[model samples]
Target: MGWSWPANPALWPLARELVKATETRQAAKSPLPHERETVAEIRHKTEASNGDNVDRTSAYLTFFRKHPEVHWALLAHLVSRNAGWSMTDLRGELLPRLLPANVQQDYFSFLERGNWLIFHDAYPQLLLYEESVKRQTTLFHLLPELHVSVFMQAVWNHFWKTGDSKLLTVGLIMNEQHYLETHMMSDETYQTTVVKTLPFALQEVLRLNLILFPYRAEGQEDGALRLAGAPVFHFASLAERIELGKRLYSLLFTSLRLREGAIQWASDKPHTGSRKDFWPHLFHDLRETAPGKAHQKKLGGCQLLPGANRLYSPALRHVWKQVRHEAPKAADWYPATKGVMRQLLLSREQPASFCAEEAYCQALEKIERAVLAKGKLFGS
Candidate 1:
């Protein structure tokens, strides 16, 4: 059966309270009561004042100053990380306890609000939250147990070929999510990667969760499942970022659901409809238009500078790399040629250049076509 999750709009005063509490925190020089060594104080003290660390701090403070409501997201990041939040756990114990099915509609609400905000440093409070380390370490050890429990409930999506009830696996086949959409593997090797890698990804999630919140219960695990610890090519002494470029290109091809100049994402299923009902509609007007094969939407700010970064638990933002039910057109592939090269060259000066982003996407497009043959042969 296709999964279905109906929307549970806000019922409890959680949203309102969260907003008010956050506002209070931001107003008082953005410090906690009894908080020592403030961000402002630290900023005042730090010698290194350039790059993302400095820039994000400035943006972080300025963003909060303007959008105090964003504090809810910030708080969510802190609480979920410390609480060791897990979607599987929530469905099994936490949600039922925090909000039983009997009272779910009354006390808790689940909304598929896509990626929340643009990427930015969420660690501005690390200095104030002294207990974060102890809390995260405790959570780290709990991963193995959580892993077993979570794995037991996992629903493999036509990927796992054969498996016993004791050990289920998404037996990897060469799928579009892989290198140029083509990573052939023996069943043995594929399963090994799945086994060794799942836990690694989980650990990565925990580490990332400490600083960001990837809410699996919210169906935000797609990116984590899709992406891996820096691709093997990252360490190779290639002249240019050949591996990184290919991975990035493949990622763009398999992940994004490009829309009307905006990136269409397969959001976490809400508590409103079947996952099936929800998914098919995404590509309808947004990703696919009439005369579908001619022109494809370009990946731009819609993807790279997503607004969801602030809305999602910060951890989710990090794993937002993997997406599902992607629909890339044959026309979407590339020219990793001079364009991508040019973008790479220019990116040093322009951190987030549309040209650079587009070039990589085009590169992915080229690679996909080379591997999969314009997606049409594969009936894209």
Candidate 2:
């Protein structure tokens, strides 16, 4: 298992599905018109600035317009590969400079107004947190009548139009312990980028992870936000551990969907060549980048992460690593112990996606394949 996912009975299905995900591969897209020009401009600036130059605002727009999730991957790489850095970089460091002048203020306004989505567990109109998304496109019914940023609204509108609210799953946003009072990333850059990116479904997931970084910090004994116990962590004994397992699954699901989705979208968008063809290709950037020392420290001795985006990768992996994979001590780490992950497998009748729905289906089907392969629900 060197440099690979662990061998836990609970994780094999996820591991198997993940393998299948890469098997078909997240298909890439053709390059958009401005990519080559943008790359040349970026390279010229990087060279001129001694390799630390930023992409031009025009190039930024075209790049994101072609691959909105690419920035999420980049940000993930930075956080996971480097240590001590936080989401604050998105605002103080990245956005103001990365975005054009005309939209900066509007972008800031989205941050100020995004308190609606970040702080509330549920609006009166929205459905309470449920495991299933009901196969509906828009989470508009999931939101309250409030002033949100232009960027968040686009995601809202897309889900409204498409009804694929898996991107807006409730556990990420609705759990007060997890989200309410969470420091919303509120970065103006993301607001700007989200508007131009290819898939509108992913913005909420990116936003959720940006804010989630504070708690994920390994050594932040006194960080601004601390979820020593999150989601169902405070529940009574056995019940609490059972719930924690579910929360872990939610994190895994969101990250993989976005990762696999990026793979699918990457091929169609124009930017580079085949996996080995270009200097910096999608998977090269997404998967090939080694975990940074800082991230390794946070992961401690964990074998792998939960999703394509390293930042949003499972913190539970760190938790599992904390006890060094000892089965007897599982209850010491969390209220629930062995065989818990089997309880959280993606259901067969889960809601359908309006687009890239097959990615969700294909990924889940791997679990069925896992079941077939192992001859049991717990595919060890």
Candidate 3:
């Protein structure tokens, strides 16, 4: 679909309603000033970086600052796009030199601290293994977290390793994961974006994910992350899969809510064409074209992911079948999933400025739109 604004005046009615709904909500709440301005700032960057020498960081932040969840979905898209060449270039040329001095120092510290919200550093061994797999014959692990990080880093590292794209990508994913995890699980009190550019920093890494690991390696084997002949794909049969999926799902929900809340805020904020006007139409378009939305009605109602036939893999298919059959015996899975998302919304940390909050909201909203379109729960 075209990213350009629709030229047809016919579509404006939907867009106008979006603006009204979004702005009306803000007017009632006494919206901040900075929040209103940043939307324009982001839009400017997004447009500027659309050319040949696309500022990977700018394009991603422009997209992510408005839609954080797209970080992953798009990362996957990019990974699968150019056979890892473009992403490799981005990692090599941009990541290391991208940030300002203080931002760089703070980013490194965030990872070192492992605060779980702003930074995530994978074991160097995992990186080594992933590289070996990409070039050699090592058994690729199916553990989603491990697989995701490796995919993100390998593509990033493939372009260049002069600095630390591996670590940077890990940190970026962890930041989003933590932000959502903390917000979802915490109460009404929590600090948002411990540091500025936190979301933008994370976006950079996500863009790299799309550059590499875009597709499931055709000949790649599965079931490596599983234990002995338990139920191949279902969480019920595999203890590790169940535990991980549970955590991953929870994290995704938190990320989703955080993102949605941000967008809601952005659409309402002042300046930069009405985000409110843009949202509903975007959602409408998404509902029809999003890769994820097609099966939402069916999938949303399913009790077990493994039981759903929508999964693309045989192993995954087997797992869902088991999960569906065993779900009656399982306790409530919604608490960790749904409850957390609600909690994150209720407990958002106040931003440093109105614009920061607005930016955060825009970033989150962008992700939400992508998720709605793609139907994936996890954020990049």
Residue 338's lDDT in candidate 2: 35
| Per-residue error (Å), model 3, residue 323 | 32
Lowest lDDT 10-mer window, candidate 2?
A: 323-332
Which stretch of 10 consecutive residues in model 1 shows the poorest summed lDDT?
A: 166-175
Total clashes, candidate 2? Answer: 22
Q: Taking the tens digit of each residue's C-alpha lDDT, what string does model 2 give over 1-380?
A: 11145355644544454343333223424334554443344334423322111111122223334434323222222122111111122222123233344454443333322322322222211221111134333333222222222223333344343444332232222232222222233234553454344322332332212212112223333211221111222221334433443443344344544333333332333222111111111112223334322121111111123442222211111211111111111011111223323333434442322232233223223322432444343322
lDDT score for residue 47 of model 2: 30
Q: Clashes per prediction?
A: 29, 22, 36
Global lDDT of each model?
0.24, 0.28, 0.28
| All candidates in order of lDDT, best leading | 3, 2, 1
**TM-scores for the candidates:** 0.19, 0.20, 0.18
Candidate 1 lDDT over 1-380, as tens digits, reads 11112122321122232233334333534234322433344334321221222132233334333433233222222222222222222222112322335333211111110111111112222221222233432111111111111111121111122222111111011111121221122224433443244433443333321112112222443332111112222111222334333333333323223110111121232111111112221112121223323223222422422321111111222212222222112221111212221121212221121223233234333332332343445443
